[model samples]
Target: MKRLLAMGCGLLVLGWANGMAAAPSPDTASVDKAIVHLAPTKGNKVQGTVRFETVKGGVKVTADLTGLTPGKHGFHVHEKGDCSAPDGSSAGGHFNPTGQAHGGPDATARHEGDLGNLVADASGAAHYERVDQQLTLQGPNSILGRSVVVHAKADDFKTQPSGASGDRVALGKIEPEK
Candidate 1:
């Protein structure tokens, strides 16, 4: 009888251990769509809103920005969600969880945050829309909690690390869309 009781207790402990080791599945519904409302950095008037929605191929990025210099500007998703710094440095480097070298969105080897550039019109307003294949709202490569940064100059895709993008002009934290 003692042996039987010990066996039963062992089974119960094993089951409890298994339950404790399991992790809950990610909430896919909460990440179906996300948005970032951008605010201008110090001495800059750049402002924008970037929307990310799960589409057929990947996440569709739609950005509408104003007060830009009428040319190309670097746009990327940084690793951190904080945009508290006056120069937008609060949001750290590009979101490159895979440790890949910097390259354009089309490059076979590129950082997850290498989003290329946003072109501004003569009126200092820019509207950009593209479907990014590398970005995701869920899973390990998720961009859900990251931040979007708009640079003052263009992203010269060939440059190393960060494409030599100039000072951050605008920043916003990516969040789930209500």
Candidate 2:
């Protein structure tokens, strides 16, 4: 048995040397979990990670963030995954594939990316966990290539287009976890 396993491994290595590679892993569309590594846009010090796991009705979002003021900060997945430009403007607007107006996560008429707020404590650390029924990980409305933006202020949840969330402080593109 061990000899056979060794031969298989050797064959794989030999294949690699001959310009052949193993089959590709499942792409983002078929993945059940994803992670985003947040980085400050420019001069900000905010940093964090956000994770998404598919659940029964929707997806579970888990976020751990730091370097925020001791208050509420807007948090939402943006339409585009581009975080290249300073101030995070390259990410585009809030993800509203359904054409709904800005609202809270629990609102029925909210945009698909309206995830509400992240409250940081006095130490500037915030840990948020929520199961979002509107956010998805598969099919036409998949958020696989989107970006999550943390704003400088709280989401009013009643504004048009995007909640009155202030300037984007940190951003990270969602990608399938390796």
Candidate 3:
């Protein structure tokens, strides 16, 4: 009887260990869509909405912004979700989980947040659409809790750690679609 009880206990322990090991890791199953509603920073009038949807190749990002200059502006997914500061400094630097250099979205070596630039039209409005392969809504590199920031100047793309983008003009936090 004693030997049988010991064997049963060992089997239970092995089963529990196996179950733990087989548990699934973090994924995007619950995050099919996300959105960020941008607001103007200090002394800026930029406002917009950015939507992220899971597509076949990657996340499809769509943005519509107004009140910007008729030119290109730097855009990125910042590391922090705080946009409380008037200057949008509350949102930290770009979200670079892989510690890559600052480059355009198509570059082979670039930060996951290096989304390049947004071009405003003559009416001070901009519409952007792209399929990003590096960004993810789920997993360890997820951008769900991060923030989006628009800069006053265009991203130079050649800068070392970050493109010499100017001051942040707009800020928003990424959240699951309601």
Per-prediction TM-score, please?
A: 0.84, 0.83, 0.84
Tens digit of lDDT per residue, candidate 3, span 104-123? 99998898899999999999
lDDT of 2 by residue, 1-178 (tens): 9999999999998977643211122244568898999999898989999999999878999999999988999999988888999989999999887788889999998888999999999999999999999887776577878899999999999878788889999999998877
lDDT of 3 at 152: 94
Name the 10 consecutive residues with the lowest summed lDDT in model 1.
20-29
TM-score for model 1?
A: 0.84
lDDT for model 1, please.
0.89
Candidate No. with top lDDT: 3
For all candidates in order, the CA lDDT equals 0.89, 0.88, 0.89
Q: In model 1, state the lDDT of residue 48.
A: 81
Give model 1 RMSD, 1 decimal: 6.8
| C-alpha root-mean-square deviation, candidate 2 | 11.6
Candidate 2 similarity to native, TM-score: 0.83
lDDT score of model 2? 0.88
Candidate 3 at residue 61, lDDT? 97
